[model samples]
Target: MAKRASRRSAAEDPSWACPCGTGLPYADCCGPVHRGEGTAGTAEALMRSRFSAFAVGDTDYLLRSWHSSTRPARLRLDPGQRWIRLEIVATERGGLFDSTGTVAFRAHYREAGRPGTLDEHSRFVREDGRWVYLDAQPD
Candidate 1:
C-alpha cells in the first residue's frame, strides 16, 4: 500500500479570536459551526455565527443558515470589504424554547480603507427545528 493517511484532521488555529467578538478562540466558537460539526442553538447564536461567516467569507454557511423562504439563489460577498466588528443592539425572543426571534445589530466594516456600518433588524424562525434567517424588518 502507498502511504496511509493520518487519522487526525488539521485543527483550526486556536490563536485567533472568533470574528464575532465573543472573546473565545475560533476553534471553540464559530469554527465548529462552519465545519458543520454543530449548528447555532438559538437565533442569537445563529446571528453571531452568520456575522462570523461574513467576516470569513463563508457564503455557503450564510445561505444554509438562511430560511428557505427568503434565501436567495446565490450570494456574492465583496472581496474588498473587510468585516471588522459586530455590535448586537438587542434581541427579541429566539431563545432555547422560542421558535421565532429578531436580532438587531450593527456590522462594521472597512472597504477600500473606508469605514462603514450596516444596521438591520433581522428576522429568524425555526425551520424543521433549526433556526434560519427569515429576512430583515422594515426600518
Candidate 2:
C-alpha cells in the first residue's frame, strides 16, 4: 500500500512560532508553503520549509519539494524520532535570483531516548521554476 499523507492539520496556531527558527508564526512563514498556498521565494526558504515538514511529519511536502532525480520512491519518518531544532550555519547564492545554492545546517533531534545532530551541507536547484532539494554533501 502507498503511504498516506499525514493527517495533521497544517493550520497550526496562528500565534505559534514556526519550527524553522524564523521567529514568525507558522501562518506567516512555512505554513503557507506546506499547504501549497504559496511557494518559497528562495532556496533558503525552501530549505527551511523542508525542515519544518520533517518536524511536522509532512512527508508529502518533503517528497514534493525534492528534486525528481534524487527523490526517493518512498519516505519513512521514524515515529520515535522528534526533530527539535534547526540552525542554519551558512548559505551560498540561494537568493531570489540564483538558480542553484547550498545551505549548511545542523538539525537537532532526539530518538530512542538519545540526542543527536545531523550536520549537512545541502544543495538545491531550480526545477521547473521552483527550488527543490537536490542532495546533501558532508558538512
Candidate 3:
C-alpha cells in the first residue's frame, strides 16, 4: 500500500557493488528493482533484490515486494543492525515461467556489534505476474 522510502542509498551509486553478493554493480543488480525502474525477472532475482533492500535500508522496496496476503501493516527495521551479505542456498520452480517458487538462503548481518545469520526457506509467488515474497516455509 505505502510506497518505498529507503533510509539510505549507497546502492544508488552505480559503481558500488551490490549487497546481494552477485558480483555485479548495484545498478546492474538490485538497484533497478529498488528504484522502480524494473521488476525482478525470477524468484531468485526477487530474493536477491530483497536482500539488497535490507542492506540499503530500503523498507519501502521490501514492503512493496511482499505478497499482499502476508504484507505487514508496518515495518520497523533495526538501525543498529547492518545487513552484510546474502547467500542463496537453492531454489525450486521459480523460473521466468513458473507461477510460484521457493528460495533457501542465508542472510548475514551484524546487530549491536554481534554477527548473525538468518537462514530461511522462503516461499514466493507470482501475483498479478510479478514476483512477491509470501512467507517462510516450515523446514
Assess candidate 2 and give its lDDT. Answer: 0.89
Q: What are the clashing pairs of model 3? A: 4-60
Tens-digit lDDT track of model 3 for 1-139: 9765453656677688999998999989888888899999999999999998988889899999999999999988888888998989999989998999999999999998999999999999999889999999989
Q: Which is the leading candidate under TM-score?
A: 3
Off by over 4 Å in 1: 1-11
For model 3, what is the alpha-carbon lDDT of residue 60?
Answer: 93
The CA lDDT of each predicted structure is: 0.88, 0.89, 0.91
**What's the CA error at residue 77 for candidate 1, in Å?**
0.5
What TM-score does model 3 achieve against the real structure?
A: 0.92
> Cα lDDT of model 3 overall?
0.91
Model 2, 22-46: lDDT tens digits are 9998889989999999999888899
What is the lDDT for 127 in model 1? Answer: 98
Alpha-carbon lDDT of model 1: 0.88
**True lDDT of residue 120, candidate 2:** 92
Error of 2 at 88 (Å): 0.5
RMSD to truth, every model: 6.4, 4.9, 5.4
| Model 3: residues with Cα > 4 Å off, grouped in runs | 1-7
